[model samples]
Target: MDLSRQRCRLWKELVLVASLLALGICQASGQIDINPDSLIGVETYRTRLVLENVTSDSQQNGPMFTGRESVLKTGDLHIRGSQLNDTGNYTVRVDAINGTQRATGWLKIQELEIPGISVNATSVVEDIDSVAAICYTNDTNVMWYVNSAPVSSNNRMTISPDTKTLIIQRIERFDSPLQCSIEIIPEIFGRSELIQLTVAYGPYGMTLTSMPNHLSGVVSAEIGTPVEMKCTAYSRPESQYRWFHNGSLLSFSGENISLPSLTWDQMGSYRCVVGNSVTQLTFYQRLQVQVPWRPKPAQKRVFTVSGSYVVVLIVVTVLGGVVFCATLIYILFKHYSTRTNRLI
Candidate 1:
């Protein structure tokens, strides 16, 4: 009798275990899921409530998420399109008759495809307003970036109504890298590669700042000394420098013109022409290079004075010559006379 009762209890226990197994049908899994914006589940809960991931509480709208894109179908979370700012951790929870089942996963968005990125003008003159830029693609919209920073619409830069084209008005001559990208879920969508811009401006701040007197706007070099002068300018797309003397071009290319030693023949009107090939704008700065060193005559003097001192030097020189000749003649005559008397 005891053995039959024990078998009966064992059979009841087996039945209870099977019932619990059926109730545990819904289980949570941590999987990396990719979606446009929302993630789905494995089992369908007709009346499902999102415990997380929505901007607003799902309870306020309805007992379940019935939004066309958010409907829980076949237990999958149907997330929808997203803005650039939408990103981060997202999850969903639903109550099953047996217990609560939730899928915990993160969201990631893929960037749109584009044929290419290009500007309306590859090279533009600086200070021009409203130059159109386009990101060539089937996509109706694209976000523009300058040097990796998002380009916002303003007076100088305006986005078109469709957002595919960007207009840059009042373009400065500063060269910058431009890119067109899309906004994704977690971060900025991958941008279309291959877009760079060049802005051409005049040779800016062109001046010869190396010569000793260059600060005074004059280029002066000392004769018989090494000469190095620089004609420098700040510009975009780099300015090509040309050095000229007496209206003739030098055979060198660079900001600096150097000579091992300067001479009087090298003294002339030295000019530096700074030109920007992109803009075809040129600027010129001219100054006379004067060598103040002069050759002195063989005459020696303790002090080199000018004006009335010249007369004093002349008088002293003549008096010294007269005294010297007289002294020599008297000495020669006395010697000759003394010798004649001795011979007689």
Candidate 2:
């Protein structure tokens, strides 16, 4: 009987522990659950609130908050045709059978206005003109981009205090297609149309080339041979060309000129003038066109024969003088020997 009483006491303690666990679980699950902590709202769009462990006695308090009935209790709050005025904090209180629970959420509505950009001039000369680009928007925060890269203030570029205007003291050709962008919401941005610039640049690096024959700025062509000349220069706008002969301008005006037949009259100084109307720059180059001097076939033969006869005559004279010197030496040695023998 004492053992049976001890077992009964243990059973009662187990029942009490199980009841306490049940109470703790009810308290924990009774807290309200909001599916999302924040939401982005747009006009004429629909949104629904998801709630857990809430009863029909629950009430939602916020701008434009509505509700519908569910099988278990009053269902989630439904917002139809949300607007900017409906953007605010929302609170829900539930009078559940277990206890009272509360939850709060946020709804943010975005402005759909886009930004614009304006420039003082549509075209400017590179390194010779200044430009002012302004971002037009209600928001003061702004950013600038050139060729799809971020722009920073330098010795020639500056940004306004509010960052709305960008001033370039000396614009370059690479700084084109400027764009201005602004952020309306986190990770949401609005950009303006691209502003393209027409930058006028130089006419430089003058060059003149000849077809068929050219040697160190001199054009050599046979008589009656056709010669073609081409001139080139680097410029933003294409360079204009003019040809001149012996300081007198020819009637031709282009990058290429042709001399149909080379003659003595064509053998003079030829000049090519390259100029740019936009940049107001000019370059000139001079090339001498000449027919090289060469002897006729008959004259060349006569000269070759004369040179050979002179060389042969010199060789024969040297050999004859050497023979005569040897003979004189032999005669002198014979006479000296005959005299010595007589004396002995």
Candidate 3:
């Protein structure tokens, strides 16, 4: 009886060991799990596959696993090549002492497509209340750069809503050639093309004035007499005119002198100084005063009526006496002549 029991016990132990070995073989033969089946147009991407044993038996065995020469044991599989034709599907197989497992994946290579770009505006004006527009083509987003640095967020530099152009408003005189670029993707470090711009300075210095350098006039008792003085000057910065007399500035406030009052005090050398910030010029005119002449009592009148009457009386009396004598003599002569004639 003892011998028979020992044989049975030994046989049961051997069967248990065989069953465990079989289970271990099934576990090693399970499928290998790869997350993705294929990859297309990928550049420098990581590939990974999970080796899974579905059987419940836990046992270690030597397996001949096959994979691409570039594949890693734990981390992602890295694949790199210059052209698209260098891509191919990769299959990994694991073979144990009892069974085998397999996993497959594909990688497709592609070349980066960089878009063409161009800039329109070449020159810009500065220091004035003006805006400059820059146009671009065949780009995703327009980026504005000034002297190679990005422009500020201030309203002066802004991107248009359409994303096709950039506007710079109220540019300063000191601002230089504002550089600009278009970026397709920031991470990809992809750039289209380079462009340059030039900034220009000033249409400065303007001046203005009237004609006729000299002015003359006369004063009279007539009320509201109009006297006009011409104003004239020249300058580059656009001079403005202001009339002055006796160091006092004249106003165009009223009808006379274009001011409220034209009193005597307002009369003097009138000067008009024309100038701007850059240069100055001056003009001048003289004014004179006049009065009516009057006579004095000391100077006597020549030929009065009394002297004329006395001279006339004396001349009349002398002429009368001469006439009487002549008449008397004539009568006597006449009497004698008559007697003689009778005697003859």
Candidate 4:
């Protein structure tokens, strides 16, 4: 009876060991986590273990070395230098004496955070060829985008031989907001901060504008009235203004100037020169000043009002003329009367 009891105890010990081994198999079916850019190894205690890196055939397209093939090895699978594409579920199978056991669980692949980026030249001439922008990271296969569109090898833009640099030949207006995105395709993509590019060009249509703008590039006003004029130009970088009068610098720096009064000397050639620092371009304009004709002064006139002196002079002249006329008439009448009476 004691021997039979010993046999029963041995059977119970063997069954307990088998139960523990089955529990370990169930635990292996659960999720297994790992980060990229490091080494990872998954092991199972079984007669034979097979691991299938089936990400390429499945929904995932992450970069992986094994592609879509399976491997049979001693109960352990080793992966070296993992990347973004190594993420997803790995098929685990165990071939035991009883039967074959299979399970699926996640193998997490954490991505490397995107880093800061820079451009060789933020601003380039409008017609300049060969504009380069580099994405700074140790990661491989960086993609570039312009205005939210994928950039590929073409006449307008091309990728470098190493695929680390993006070259844009003959920049265009839409080249602003250039970006670099790092991803393994289909999923797991991180974009760098946007880096804007400016196209430097001309300082065109230079003119002297005023409140009234007496004329194009000319400011005219009354000689004593205050007059103000502004120098204006267009360019990628704003142009600087300089004012000169008769070959003499009137202002060192300013966009606009005010004149208190105009004189004969100030009525000569007035020039306004504009310069663009980016394009190294300089242009100037000259304005002529003329004075209007002035009218001559008028002659002076005199007037008087006196009554007594005028009356006395008029009466004396009339009385003397009357007396002389009467005396001459009396002598002539006496002579004429005597001759006429004798004849009758």
Which candidate number would show the highest TM-score if scored against the true structure? Answer: 2
Q: Model 1 over residues 245-344: C-alpha lDDT tens digits?
A: 9999988889887767888888778788999887778998877777664688798769669978999989999999999999999999999999999999
Q: Clashing residue pairs in candidate 3, if any?
A: 205-236, 206-236, 206-237, 206-238, 207-238, 207-239, 208-239
Q: Candidate 2, which ten residues in sequence have the lowest lDDT sum?
A: 6-15
What digit string (tens of lDDT, one per residue) describes model 3 on residues 138-168? 5556566555566654767666765655566
TM-score of model 1 vs. true structure: 0.49
Residues 1-344 of candidate 2: C-alpha lDDT, one tens digit per residue: 12112111111111111121333322224567666857775545555556565433322232322332121233355566655665656565543345555676666655545688999997787778999999998888888898789888889889898999999888888888888888766656678899999988778788899976678888878889998999998878788899999999998799998889888888789999998888788889988888775787764434445878988989999999999999999999999999999999
Q: What is the TM-score of candidate 4?
A: 0.47
Worst 10 residues of 3 by lDDT: 6-15
Candidate 4 least-lDDT 10 residues: 6-15
lDDT for predicted candidate 4 compared with the true structure:
0.59
**How many clashes show up per model?**
12, 0, 7, 2
In model 4, pairs of residues that clash are: 62-85, 63-85
Q: Superposing every Cα of model 4 onto the true structure, what RMSD results?
A: 17.9
Give the clashing residue pairs of candidate 2, or none.
none
Model 1 spans with C-alpha error above 4 angstroms = 1-116, 135-142, 173-175, 184-190, 211-215, 219-222, 251-253, 293-344
Report the backbone clash tally of model 2. Answer: 0
